[model samples]
Target chain A: MSAEMVHTVSPDGPFTSISLAIESAKNGDIIEVNSGTYNEHVIVDKTLNLVGINQPKIDGGGKGTVVLIKAPDVTFKGFHVSGSGESLSVEDTGIVLDSAQGSIIEDNSLDDVLFGIYLKKSSGTIIRNNNIVGKDLPIAVRGDGIRLWYSSDTKILNNTITRARDLVMWWSGDTLVKGNKIEKGRYGLHYMYSNNNVFEDNLFSENYVGGFLMYSNNIKFQNNIFARNQGPATGYGIGFKDLDDIVAKENLFVDNRIGLYMDNSPHSVDSWNTLEDNVIAFNDIGISFMPSIERNIIVSNSFVDNAEQVEVRGGGTLAGNNWFTNGRGNYWSDYVGYDENNDGIGEIPYKSESLFESLIDSYPNLRVFVFSPVAQAIELASDAFPVIKPEPKVTDNYPLMNYKIPQRYEAEEKGFSYKLFVVSLLMVLIPSISYVFIKRKI
Target chain B: MDTKNILLIMKKEAGESLKNRWFVLYTICFSALALLVLLFSTMGGDIAGYSGFGRTAASLINLVLLFIPLIAIITGGVSISNERENGTLPYLLSHPISKNEIFVGKFLGLLITIWFSILLGFGLAGVGVAIIGQQGDISGYLLTVLLSALLAACFLSIGFLVSVYSGKASKAIGISVFLWLFFIILGDLGIMGTTVAMDLGIKQVFALALLNPTEVFKVASVLVLSPRFEILGPVGVYAIRTFGQQGVFYLLFSILIFWTLIPLGYGYLVFTRLRREEK
Candidate 1:
């Protein structure tokens, strides 16, 4: 099978141009292009294997698309795709797979393109192990390392993407994005209007927004690491906005501004998401649930050495074995509590100093005094006098620190019950009232 | 004098409207806003996770209330004023038709055109909502469109009155634009100022806010569509408490009738008086 379809593209024949070689290729063929700079746009419209020997390059001549794949069961490997121009017009991707299925794009390098590889309305594709590095400073460009737009059922794995504006899956569903290293992008792994997608074992480090999930549902992120994503405008390690039914667990967020930010969402149950075992050291706030956020479960997370541990400006259920590091537990580094029990857990829960912390939060300049002796004394006095730390309301008695707990949809069920009660009451009243009047006359 | 002549004049006005650039532009702008309404409404569920009837209705009402007056004032302001400025009103008036017939025919033509635009916008919005699998409250949408159309008619009549009274085209345009802007933006600002000055509670202020036609439409539409969110403000609270659910419908109908008749009646008197003065 290898011998029958082995076609070599070199200086001879129509091999100089990629388009010419692809025109003559058959199913199960290996059209191996040799090392040269071929400035052409190649289209694969058949089920075949296309291999690039010694890293052959396809340049788009800075005008149009480089290569477009419209075939099922096709593989593009070991190529350096380059030369995508900047345009505010319609989408011009370096490599576009439009309506292609079962395609594998692996072990390729995409550089200096508007978009590295865009999968538009395509499904059942595996985009794996590609090194996509955009330009250092984007020239007013709007592109992604690998974008899946209006596509579904694709697996994106182990790809290293950097310097792109956004890594996006827009208006798509049922995707598995795992084991990728995404950095220096505007937003890492932005999911918009997509549903039922699982993102796990990914490292989103040093990005503008280290993962923004919005307008999506039934999406889960687990075992990911978010680190060093700090900028004036670029922060928020994991931000969930207007999302529902999302489950995040066993993730490590260290030294990022606002480790977990949940905003404007309701009916989302976040439980057993371990902000423990994470070095949430040196951030503005560890967890911030804003005013519009409601009905979420924030439990069993450790807040260690952050400027502010937890800022709950919203109404949500905060319960179940969580640890705060303000002298009573979990290593504040300013802890004044003696280990009377010698148990790992502190004897008393920590009482955060309120007025001082509020001042520090509103006026960040006061944070310079955070490590001062005076500040330490104040924190100790506040703890001893007990001015802060709302009383613990335990929802679950024994909360596991590391397990991925499925979010119970009990709230939704209760809401449904109320609706049913109203319906039944109306059903009973309408008929009973009419029957009584008729019976009275009779 | 006859119904056939009135119909002919209405058709002629409609045909003339099709060629008007501003009318075409207005239609496109309205269509765009309708698209935005659909996008926000559809995505609101995924973003907020509480895509109730109230939220959907609130969004639709908010869009209509914001844009309707602007469209109404612009379209209505120029309808008669532009004809007079262009020296075509006298020629049309010289025909055998009575002054009342010409006025009624033109008014009907404009109303029909604006209603057609509103329906087109709503149809597009409906398709978008369906595509996003959002089940919007149809009755709420219909109520909003109807009330908004009435509001538009009121603004149109007001604009036509200005067009009839003003000496120059520029003055008419300026006055119409200023009136719409004042009602929409400045009126809210003024309400906020008065609230602060009087130290009145937000509810009392909102009750006073209903005096502003834009705020009235906004409050009325919200009441009709989303009774649940009606308690968010003083105006809403007072409205629900005073009117109850049935009262809400009654108040809306009353407001609609009042605004519609007052402006059109004024415009009819001014227009008739102006015609006599010209003669």
Candidate 2:
């Protein structure tokens, strides 16, 4: 066994092949691949440091996965991997770390890869700073960006994944996915039957769906941005379905069709989520909740200029949800009520009512009337006659008169500047008055 | 300048128009049409017994924009022209009142008649809706009535313009109908079609929307009533930006008041100058 020996492998080096370098190397040995293209699919069977110098290319010639790490404590880095076989059944991946504990796969560029980096039963592995872009094909043919199956206590960080299907975690627990920019994919981050995951500071933009935590619990999404994740039928910034014990704080969801969509979340009697200080603006529906979503406390957030501030889907109720915490409610752009006493809280409650939202819970066909005059009339009528209206979709008893979404979110917002608006208003009015006067004087 | 003379003239003009049997018929017609609009909404919806008030009021906005201006113009268009043709204009001028007084009195009288028709039409519909179903939006209903009255006043001024300028009632009425057709239907379509064919920007289209008095009413009325008007996208955004929440109220009110006053002023100027020239 070559202990602490450095085997340099290149296309023109003495040990020209990476597999040969690995065969000659021992556990804890280093094999550095220099610049050039290697066409064979390599398997790291020993626990060694397989680092790429000058960014060497590992081409699988459109065959199987380019790199498969089966050993414990293997460190792979800085390789350009491409040309994995296009087979959904085979779960063809550009890189695979199977039960590779204490491993690191960092700063690698994976192109034309089906499954970018698949972690199967791998624990304590760090996958950071990797750029994984899928082939230019239809979404059905594309595979997962980074799929973690039965992988526990993993750190997936700072990876830019685009055109790949989903950054998914299934049956994985205690995962930390942070600082990743996921764009133009199906779901930016999707969790199913996973628990105790924390996704922080990640940007999920232009994906078909931003993120969804399904059948998962004890998740925390902190300070993330979900923007422009639009679809033909369903565009969600973040969705929670049948989950429990979630905390989403200081997140920003902007310009999505549906910003925060929750269904059957906080499922149990004792289950709850604490969402605070988030900024949700300019989405089609700022927050849409399914009926029967209970015990969720959402407070100190700002919902600005959405088509409908809040909506309830499937004719159900958001029971037991606390709109205000500690006497502080979210700021809404459409709230006409003000705090006459100058205490920052509105004197009247802010009602989240829209014609389509009010009716779509019962008649899905009413969604077609969204933003129509008919829907507007119905919404106004519902507000006037509470008896005819269904239960309040979402009411903020202590709504903030001004947006308290923090200064960071304001930079992203095309805020309606009161001063500029007043000036533009004056500019519009002066001409009208003059026109009236001039015509009359004639 | 004389309130007593203006009131006396206003009372006589009001009495003559109010006594007409068509006032009651118009009021009844408005009530039935408003009810039909509400019923259409109810039939379209499957939720509760009645659709929401905002939906009804919003739809009624379109209805009000269409019919009120036409009705007001027809009713007022015949006023001065009919009086002039019947030799009553010379008789009325033989009195001690000024031309301004007669004009103001007739304008106020026509505005009142228009208001009466609107209130009666909408009041009956409001009562009917309240009685049959729950009151969807009483404030919205009232706002509709108020906006509709303003709209009627705006067109009545236009009618007065046609009336004072024309030599006969038939010509005045024809001009009023043409004005109605232009403002209510073809104005928007022509401008929109031309702009689209010319590939004009949203700003141009928005500017064109502000050109017609009725179009201004249409934008402002719906803009104030429903935030859903934001769905108009870029052009709507530009319009909303130009006139913010409170600005829209002022802008539309100014436009309506302008529509009401400017035409009467122009007509008064023409009438007094023509009579002076004849003398």
Candidate 3:
């Protein structure tokens, strides 16, 4: 083959439009697009390298997909793509790769687009260092930030997506999602029927649901931070459904409604899910499990200050799951047992047997009385009368007695404010001074 | 009608309140309790895993809910009945002041005393929180203070009504304590039991809860502390859907104000009729 040629596309170049340059180039040629707006939909049918100088703009003119890749080994980078059509049915996107394998899309900014970057049957694609923002539409109407359908072996790295629906992967296996920050969206990562995916160092905040994994297996979530996903209906840090061999370790679930929601997970009889060393704190409920969920081992996790630590939906005991593995169990904030041996584990087993909490699990509407005197009264009465105390929901034989606050949460605590100190002092001093002055007048 | 007479009576009432041994004892005890609760709740820092200001503020709300009404009701319950028992009401009625002046002056004076004690107690506790507690938003704490004062005023109005109609000071005190129990304990339990047993609808439960001033206070405090009142669950969602966030807050606030004003107004009318009968 001849040496690969370089085609230039600029406002005053031989080829004014990117599509014209692409049509004139061969399969392995490089098209260098200069800094100018190209308002045309460019389709690449052969393998080519499209490089943008000074981040040239590719405006879709509010039409269909801006760039369509139909060949393998395509490299597209350093461009601002915007103004795709706003039809969800049509799947208008900033860039859509169709059956394109071994493609690299990087260092691009997408805005006002329906779907940011979509891959369909595109394997071995790398989407990295890109910023994606959806069109200014309601959450239900907005399109996915990045979606992969039947696209396996894709690596999504160091991307920021905001105000989009979700970063979704359907039937995409062996994918790696890392170092992504997704905020204010519906779901940060929505995975279904994907296997062997690794999610590491991703931060999802202020979204409706942080990560929803369903019908997926062998997924690992490590060192991910899910915070403030307090949606009205379902604010879950991470939800697991009908999955097996999942490992979630060293993750932080904070300030969400339900930290980890499980429903018939580990569906296969021989499979077991593992959740270890995760800090679930300050959520409305630490973990919510379906009545019949089993075959899971939850250990060494810190369940801290959640209003309800573990709630079994529809009012069934959590007897099926194992709370301790290898003589080590989770740390619970409400454990009243003593550590007689000082072995870092409570001598008495930590049991969730709150009568009121059990009642609330059965009838969620009773949650309206949370923190009310009636709730306190029920607790007091149950303590006074053990007969009314229901069976233990779950028991940890070797519950950890002490837990160090995670480094990230500790760093989030700003030091004591002197301004608040002054205000508090004034709140006291003003009343005292006024009282003294009035006393003297009297 | 006379501002000077009202001020004079207010001054006398405030002076008497400050000098009374029981009042002084109650004030010291409340302040010390507030300080202790704050200290205990925030003792171990991060190792204990307390959620900083949010948890401390929740503790303060509970303490205020249980304590403030008791103090206000006791103080206002005896204000008029004790004077009546001592023949001081008749003696004061013979003075140049109208009955309205005495009633309004007494209410304002006791309100000042209650507000001062509560603010001072929580202020001292707040200072401790500011010094050692974990750093988070203290706006919840400030909201607690403001709402506790409103709660105290509401109960004080109820106490005034009890004091006006009771035949004896002891009777007034007994009635005040009973009212406290009814609102704080029995009434809430009844609402919960009835809602569960009768399977009452959400609107009925909401209305029943608002009927008690303390429940209104509790709802308002939770609304401020939890975002979208998520902690309250379905009731909170219903409230948000029925009345937007600000709407629910203002509605609860107006209900508290009504709790304060109606009882105060009714007590004033009763006291006026008593004066006319005396004449």
Model 1 DockQ class: incorrect
* Cα TM-score per model: 0.50, 0.62, 0.95
Interface RMSD for each predicted structure? 18.7, 16.2, 3.0
lDDT for each residue of candidate 1 in B97-183, tens digit (9 for 90 to 100):
876677777776677666656655665555544554555566676677777778888787777777667656777888888998777
Candidate 2: segments with Cα more than 4 A from true spot: A353-356, A380-389, A412-442, B1-279
lDDT of 3 at A50: 94
Query: Candidate 3: misplaced stretches above 4 Å?
Result: A405-409, B20-55, B133-135, B275-279
Best-to-worst order by lDDT is: 3, 2, 1
Q: Which candidate is the best by lDDT?
A: 3
- Sorting all predicted structures by TM-score, with the top scorer first, yields 3, 2, 1
Predict model 1's lDDT versus the native: 0.65
lDDT per residue (tens digit) for residues B78-145 in model 2: 98898888888888888888888888888887777667667666655555444444435444555666
Candidate 1 off by > 4 Å: A1-4, A265-279, A292-300, A313-339, A360-442, B1-279
Between prediction 1 and prediction 2, the one with superior TM-score is 2
lDDT for A162 (candidate 3): 91
